[model samples]
Target: MSTDTSARWRLRAHAALGALVAALPAWASAAPRFADYPVPAIYQGRAAQPLLADAHSRNYATRLRDAATEKPDFAGRYVLATWGCGASCTMSAAIDAKTGTVTWLPFTVCCWDADVEDHLEYKLNSRLLIVHGARNEQGGGTHYYQFNGKRFAEIRTPPRHAPHPPGDHQ
Candidate 1:
């Protein structure tokens, strides 16, 4: 090919490569991969037995490995795992530090906040776990839960106000 023709071809190739590289991050982020973050050994070691005993737990265990977002050392002795089952549906499980016991919390509906992109929050140095969920058409609210030696149980009254718009309130 002539010099001008070859130069044009090279420019087009460079542009195509640049476009592909630029699109990679968006493509990768479109689906969150749980495998990217493996469950910690503390939880993984004890999860096999209980997970194998029941089919549902086994499925959840797989999903946990595939999609769950883990917070290690949560509450000083527990590793908290959260994953989305579907739109607005979420599930959580906790691994006890002392016993390695995995406790699966009830499946919660409308637990996702599209605005903030998170469903769970924990207070520093406090045992309170605030779970956000939709209450009605107006908005969503938070339910406070406390780990009561056995499981996380809802304590104290939930927030009464509607969920403020993102950036309006935190």
Candidate 2:
């Protein structure tokens, strides 16, 4: 009778463990492929500038690479600062080596400010895709543009936040 009870507990434990493992979110390596990029051979516009492609497409990825290059073993991490625009404004995006889809991480509130200027920094992920169009202060008007391994879409941003303190915490 005791042996039978032990066996049942063990079986239940195993099932619970399996369920927990299945519920976990996938890691960057396991992230789903967002889109299929174009071949560089058919790339249009400016010549294939490998570094530029990564730098201009994403912000965080570019910062990580620059830090890593300047100082060995630079950590690929960043903080996002979203400037508040009164309904309808453009947002810049950035990608990382492990990032599948480019996420917009605006480094600066305004696009004009060079020091805190918001420029899209690109990095080599598996493939590259660009999302253009403005996002309202609340949320609306989202668009997407695709880039091969090279070439980036030109986007203009309206004045969203002031460049005084820098952080867009308002």
Which residue pairs come into collision in candidate 1? none
> Candidate 2 residues 108-164, lDDT tens each?
222233353332222232233222233333322222233432234423222333123
Query: Which runs of model 1 end up more than 4 angstroms from their true locations?
Result: 1-55, 64-71, 109-117, 135-140, 162-170
lDDT by residue (1-170, candidate 1, tens digit) is: 99999999999999999999999866643321223222333333333222334565677766545322343445545666666666666677765545545677654637445565556765323455666675322345655566653677765433445343342122
Winner by lDDT: 1
Candidate 1: 10-residue stretch with minimal lDDT: 31-40
* Candidate 2 error regions (>4 Å): 1-15, 18-121, 128-134, 140-170
Q: Give the TM-score of candidate 1.
A: 0.51
